[model samples]
Structure formats: C-alpha cells, structure tokens
Target: MKIKHLTRALILGALLSITGAMSSCEKQTQTQAQAQDGQYVKKGEGALSNVMLATIQSAAYTPTLPTKATIIESPSNVLSPRTENDNQNQINAAITNLSNSGGGTVLLGSGIFRIKSPIILKSNVRLKGGGQDVSIIKRDESWTNVEGRGMLESGGYIEDLTISDLSIDGNRPESYRMSNQFPLFGIEITIDNGGTTRNNRVYITNVKIVNTGMGCHIKHTNNVILKGNYIVGNGTLASSTHSLPTFFHNVYLRSIDKAWVYGTNYFKDSPGGNGLNITHLTNLTVEDNIMTGNNFRGIRLGGSSSIILVRGNTVSSNTDFGIGLAYDETGQPQNFSIIDNTVNNNDNNGIYIPNNTKNGEVQGNSLSGNSPLNIKKGTNLTNVSCQAN
Candidate 1:
C-alpha cells in the first residue's frame, strides 16, 4: 500500500511539471507577438535581411519612373565666365523649361558653379552633375536667404525629382557665420509653408556635401531615396555664437515616408552633430551606410516614427550612443528592426531604447568595445536572439 501511494504522488508531480512548462511557453509566445506586433510575421529566420536587401537592390536597379535622356549643360557650353549669375541663370532656365515641358533631367558638366541664391527644382525635373570631384556648387558668401529656405530649394508639392552626382560647399566661412540663421543647408526639400503635404518622390545620390549648418534637410517628403552620398559637417570652418559646434546633422529627415537611406557616408569633424537625424518618419529602411566620427549619435529616430529597418551599417567613433531611439511626450517608438550591423567605438551605448520605446528586435549585430546595449523601459521586450561578438 505504501509503495502504491508513493507511485501515485510521483505521477501527479510529473504531470504538474509538464503542464506548468506548457503554460510558461504559451505566455512567452504571446509576449513576443505583442512586442513584434506582426512586423516580421511572414519573415522567416535568417531571411529578413535577404528580403530587405533584395527590395533595395531592385529599387536601385530599376527606378519606377523613367530616368532617361538627361539634358546636359556646362559653363563651357553656356555663357562664358560662368559667374554666380551665369551658372544660376543657365541652370534655372534648364529646370524651368524642362518642368514646363512636363519634366526632364538637367545635367551639369564638370565645373565650379558659384550659386548666389537657391536653385529651385520643379516637378519631374532632375539635377545631375559630373562626379562630385568634378562638379562643384560653391555657395556665394554674399547670398543669404533663398525665399527664407535652403541653398538648393524645391518647388512646393513637386514629384519625381532627382538630385545627384555633385558637390555642394556651403562655405560657412567665418564671415558667413550667423547663429540665428545657422543651418544653411546644402539642400532643403521643404513643404510649402502653409501646405500640409508637398515635395514627394525625391531621389538624391552620389553627392558630396560639406561645411554646412546641415548637409541635407528634408521635411514633409514622401518616397525619398538618399543613396551613395557623402555628407560631412566639418565644424572647424564656422563659428556659432550659440554653441561651439555649429552644425546640427549631416542629413535630417522629418515627416518623411517610404524612404531608403542606403550606401551613404555621413561624418562630422566636431562633436554634438548627428550623422542622420530622423523624426516622425514611417516605412523607412536605413541600411549599408557608414556613419562615424560625429559628435552625437550615428542614427537617431525621434518623435513618432514607426516601421523602420536599420541593418548592415558600420556606425562607430561617435561621442554619444551609436544608435538611439527617442520619443516625445505623446509619442512612442515602435515596430523597428535593428539587425546585422557592426556598431562599435562609441562613447555610449551601442543601441539605446529608453522608456516608452518598445516592439523592436535587436539581433545578429556585432556590437563591441562600447557601452552595452541598454533597454531602459517597457515590458514584453523582444530582444529576438542577439549574438554580441
């Protein structure tokens, strides 16, 4: 009778253990689903990167719109001397004519074109140049505000625009430093002041932008592509009364959607500058870029940004965290994937997720020689199997 009783107790204990284990696993799976929120629902293991890469490669290979028959121009071909007035007039003429004719390319030949005011881009007009080393757009010191916007501004509510293969020297020389109006960026794609939605379907590539308050600033834009550009903020040239490092970022994007920032290089000589500053964005992919030697973070997603993929980038040698996720009082960063990157040599954490930021994956990254990954807040955190080397 004693032996039979002992056997019954053992059987009951084993059954309970199995049931408990099953319950625990179910809870874990629920948590993962909640955290991921169906972002990677159809993505198989080890294939997420491949899928995203294919999308990028295809996009780069086959542009959705027609980009043939570039209209080429040059100082040598246009009126001679190609002073600030000459170059600006020629380029503007080409763009205006093309836009009026339903859009085309305006290619600039190898030369240094001094621009004293904004080069406005109209709908369906592309501005191409000789290689960055050969074609230069040097900002004239005498020039200040282009309708209170950037050196190269865009037409309001424009679409199918391309700016590629050039160098823009902001020339923020000591004489040109005005802290109040400091961010004299090389390119600024802005929505019309009173318009809610403008500036859509823009592409920028193979450009070298330097010595500016900000290299490139895009606001309220959609379907943007910034690829193979070298954006550097050499802060030594300008003196800001407000702060030591006058420059803010190499590239700044806000209220942008369906954008891909790939194969670009962003760096800064001084501290307190960001390689890329993103705010209130959606459906964005930032991959295969080099962001290093900046004052602040390499990449920052602030405000109410969602559906982001950051992968295969080398972000290092920064003063602050390598990759940072930020949120405002009413916003929470969500639906992000941080994978397969080599982020190292930063002064702060490799990846930072503060309170109010959740629903993300940090996996398959080689993060070393920096502050460890920090998950400051939020529950049901889905780390998704990271192997830190």
Candidate 2:
C-alpha cells in the first residue's frame, strides 16, 4: 500500500511539471508575438547634440573579430569542373554545413566556379581562395540575376566577415552578351538600419573584380576595409556618352561610417559613373590609391559626408571632375580635408567645392591641366582654407 501511494505521488508531480511547462511556452509565444508587432528596437549610439564631438569622445571602433574558434570541413571541390552541373547546390550545401557547425571558413580551391545564383554570405566566416587569380568565380551562361543582386551578396546584419584573394568576373561580357542583360554587380552588401544600426567589420582584400555595374557597392556598414583590390571597366553598357548615369560606379559607398579604403587600383572605371563615390558617410579615410581612365569623376564625395580625409592619392584622366564635393541641403559636409593628392588632367574641375560646405581645408595638392578651372569653389564658403595647391 505504501508503494502504490508513492507511484501516485510521482504521477501527480509529473502532471504538474508538464502543466507548468505549457504555461511557460505560452508566455514565451506571447512575448515573441509582441516583439514581432513592430517593437523590435535597433541598436545605436544614443542622442548627441554635436555629432563630431561625439565621434571625438567615443572610443575607436574596431572590426577584426572572428566569432568562432572551430575549423569546420573545407570543401575544396565546391565548384570545380567535377561539380559542374551542381555548382549552386554544392556551394550552398558547403556554406550551410559550415554555418550549422557554428560558422567557419569556406576554402575555395583553384578553379573557375560558375554559378547561376547569388552566393549567400554568413557572419563569422572567412571566404578565402588560393591567392588572387587562381580562384575565379564567373556567372553561368543561363544565369539571370534576379532583383539586381550581386555575385557575392551578404544577407542581413553580418559581422566579422573577411573575403580575400579571389577574382570575381561578374557576368563577364561573354555571358551577358548572350543574354542581353545588364546591371550585374560584384560584391554588393547592404544593411538597412536607417543609421540606427550598422553592419560591422567586413574586410575585402586582394580581390579583383571586373565587368559589372560596380565592383564594390556597399551601404550602411561600419568599420569596413577595402584594401589592395583591382576594380575595373564597370558600367558595361556599350555607350559613348560623356555623362554616364550617377548610379554606375567603380567603388560606391553610401551611409557608411568609419571606413578605411586604401591601396585600391581602379582602372577604366564605370563607363557610367565615378571611379570612387562616397555619399552620406562620416570618418572616412581614402588614401594611397590610384584611380585613372575612368569615364566619370575620379572621386566624388557628397551627400553630407563629414570628417573625410582624402590624401596621398593620384586621380587623373577622367571624363569629369577629379575630386568633387557637392552641396546637400540635408546637411553640409564638414571637416573635409583634401591634402597631398595628385589631381591632374581631368575633363572638369579639380577639387570642385560647392556652396554651403563648412570647415574645409585644401592644402598641399598638385593640380594641373584640368579643364574649366582647377580648385574651383563657390563664394559662400565658411571658414574654409584653400592654400598651396
């Protein structure tokens, strides 16, 4: 009789535990539903009266973090000739496998990997190749890039990612020639947070990208580095117009914060737009790069950029201005320093600054042989110094 009483007690305890678990799950579901009802808060730096003052006071932002410690399997045969008809599936499978195992590296071997779809990138992963020209990623003959996606496109909110030592021939002329489709891009990453939150810590080094709309088009990111890359001959629409559309660019950055772009060689850039275009950005340092033979401006900066330092670069022989800073009604560009650059032989002005810009300095630059006027500025400049050009 005592044993029978103990069994009944055990059964009663089990039922109570299950009922409590159900209640806990119901509360969790309700919390999730509430959060999904437009209540998710994006992270950001809190309110600041003076933006530049806040930038000066805050600690430096760094993005060289590797999230995982384990080394997952590296599929060297992801897109080799052996994986011919199953290139997309094999590549996705490898990436998914690595992601499921808590994020790792995708080691692409030396081969021409052809794909018909965009390769999704995950956070905490390094996509490495066998040095620059060994691993080439090209689009297949039957490929049609839906929604104007890039050859290597990153999804939402990725961080601690590095892509190095590869060549991406995005929709090369032969492939697009057959399909008559334009607007192909190489290495496009976008994160939409409206300046509330920025995707962090992306480094693309020693990569070569060519034959696309733009070599690198990044938006709303933080602490990015584009170093030692060769980007060329973008805006591949066979046109002879001097004024290419502004949307086409070789290296386009928008709404970026804290970027370091250096040692990039952009040749014959953007049959449609500028070689390097920066807009709505802050704390950008562009140095030691060569931008030549572009169809449009060599480097164009506008859209309320702030704290930009353009130094020690060569910009020459473009269809339009060498380095241009235009007016933006939303907010004028502040603390723009054009120093120690070689700006020569462009079709339009060299270092053209429009009205309403503030606290600018153009010093120690070598400007010669530019059309219209070299170092032209509007009369409404405030506290700006243009010396020794």
Candidate 3:
C-alpha cells in the first residue's frame, strides 16, 4: 500500500510539472504576441506624429501663421546707349544682384524700356512689373540684329514671377507686306536655350504682343505655363525673311515635358502656326484657353506620345478645322484625349482624326454648330467617344 501511494504521488507530480510547463509556454507566447502588436501600432503612427501633434497644438493656440514678404533692392538709375532706354543697366544689375542673393523679385517700375538685346534670367530671379499695361518692354528695331534679342530668353530656374503687363513689338513693319514671307514674325519669349535638363518655368500673364512675330516661342523647355495673355499677329512687314510673320503661329515647343497653356488667346494663320502647337512632347495639357481668328486650326499636335488632355477650351472663327491631330514623320500619335471643348464656326471639319492616328478619345464636345461630329481617316483609330449632331 505504501509503494502504490508513492507511485501515485510521483505520477501526480509529473502531471503537475507538465501542466506548469505548458502554462508557462502559453503565457510566454501571449506576451510575445502582445509586444509585437504594440510595436506595430507604434510604427503605424509614423515618426512625424510628434511634430504634427505639436504643430496642431500650437495652431490651436495661435491666431494665424506667421508670414512675411520680401522686397528686392533696385539698381542705380542708369541708361543704355545702344537701346536709348533707361533702366537697362539697372535691370541687368538688379537681376544679377537678385541671383546672387539666392532668388528674389526684380520690380520694373512704370516705364517703357526699349530693349535692344535679350535679357537673361537667373535661377529664382523674378522680373516683375507693376501691371501688364503700365510696364512695357518695347523692342528696338535696330537692335534686332544682336545675337540674342528675342525679348525674354530664360535658361535658368525661374519661378513665382510674373512677366506680364508688358509689350514686345518686333518693329519689323517692312516685312509684313510680302505674302510669301511667312517666317518673319519674331519670338516674344524663348525658353531653354536648347540646353539639356534645364527645368525652367515662366508665368506670362495679362500681357499683349501686338503686330509682332511669334507671340511666345517655347523650345526645349519643361513645365511652362502660358496664361491670361493676348497675342495678336496683325502687322504688315516690307520683306519676309526666314523669320515667322507677326501673326504667324510659331509657338515652337519641341522636346518638352509636362507643359500647359491655359486662359490665353492666339490669332494666327498657317499650318504650324496656331494658338497651341505641340511637337515631340509628352504629357501636355491645353485647358481653358481661347483660340479665335486663327487662320489655321486652333490646336495641332504632331510627334507627341502619352496622354494629351484638351479640355474646357474654345476654338472658333478658325479658317481650317478646329483641332488637327497629325502624326509625326513616322505617323503615330500614341495616345490622346479631347474632351468637353467648345468648337464652333470653323470652316472645315470641327475635329479631324486621321487614319494614322491611334488610341484617341473624343467625347462630350459641342460640335452641332460646326460640321461633322467626328472625321476619321485611318483604320487604327480606337476608343473614340463622341455625340453627333
């Protein structure tokens, strides 16, 4: 009886030990899981949570965020003899000084500066005016021969500046008379300087380019925004050279990325000359713009790839089709979208989509006041959506 009792005691002890071990292992597993859950929650909140919380707390107590505007210094009053213009030296000096000080705004007081040469803008330098009409940069006809006299040619990084309320007259009155001389119109604003990887930006707003050649010539640029400007090409020149005409649609934009032309007006006549002509570009957006009195189509695209969005624009009184999509030398427009545009009173078809064009979407545009709703030339056209008259 004593031996059996001992055996029973031993068995009971072993069972108790096993249960204790299992319980301890389970407890350890649960603790490790709890620790991992806590770590995940902390990591999910991110490292900036403390800073964001502090900022919110401060904002709740403060009335407004502190802010201030910096006013740039002006150069000494000096005049340039070549252009017979006041503030030419001052303007150059001010721009240089602004560039040296990282970046700042260079204000042009109310006056006309007869610029004989093109002004080079530095990185972060803003050449601004009091208003578009008040501050004018008139072109000196004699100085047009200078190497770089094409109004404002920007190669540096420019941002947050207004180059508007100014006038650029190419002053070539003699070349306007020849009908065959279609290339004499000079460029108002030329960008990129044909440099590689020059990411320059410009805001040309509330200005007028009258009786001059190409309004704003953008070449080899990226992220250019042309807005709220009036470009009228109605001048008669005596002899036409290789230069584009005053109203010639020579807004040359080649090899550009992510460009936008919005809320502006262009009047011109020709195949390459229109309100907006994009070539060899990717990711273009032409929105809320008005192209009237154009001799050719309003918007023309050639040699462009990727999705080009044309929305909320007005194209009227054009002698040719409202929109023309022609393939490049190789005959391919990879993808395009034309939506919600108001095209009316055009002499030819409202929208011309050729046979070589592929992967285009045309929808929700008003074409009743014009000709046929959609015109397709080739077999490769796909994903086209339109409401006919």
Best by TM-score: 2
Best by lDDT: 2
Q: Which residue window of length 10 is worst by lDDT in model 2?
A: 25-34
Residue 278, model 2: Cα distance from true site in angstroms? 0.7
The TM-score of candidate 2 is 0.75
Report the error of model 2 at residue 241, Å: 16
Evaluate residue 287 in candidate 2 and report its C-alpha lDDT on the 0 to 100 scale.
83
Best to worst by lDDT, what's the order? 2, 1, 3
- Against the hidden true structure, what lDDT does model 3 obtain? 0.55
Candidate 3, residue 125: how far the Cα is off, in Å = 1.2
How far is 242's C-alpha from truth in model 2 (Å)? 20
Report, for all candidates in order, the number of backbone clashes: 2, 0, 23
Considering only N, C-alpha and C atoms within 3 Å, which residue pairs clash in candidate 2?
Answer: none
lDDT of each prediction vs. the true structure? 0.67, 0.69, 0.55
Model 3, 1-389: lDDT tens per residue?
99668757755654454344323211111111112211232434533221211000010111111111232444323332334564355677777777777767676667677765667655556566666666777666655453233566654454433465565555545444234342333343344455555444555666666544455666665566666776665323233454533334635565666676677545454333466666776777777887766666677777754567777788876766787777767455556767677777777667777774666666446653445433333455555433211
Q: What does candidate 2's lDDT look like per residue over 1-389, in tens digits? A: 99668757755654454344323211111111111222322334322111221000111222132222223344344345335634656666766677666777777789888888888776766777787789888878688644367888887777777888888887565543222246677888887667687778788889888877667888887778888888887754344343433356778888877788787555455666678888888888888898887877899888888888888889999888998886566665678778778988989877788876677777557778888777777766676765445
* Candidates in descending TM-score order: 2, 1, 3
Which regions of candidate 2 deviate over 4 angstroms? Answer: 1-86, 174-181, 193-195, 236-246
Residues 16-54, candidate 1: write the lDDT tens digits: 543443233111111111113224325345323112110
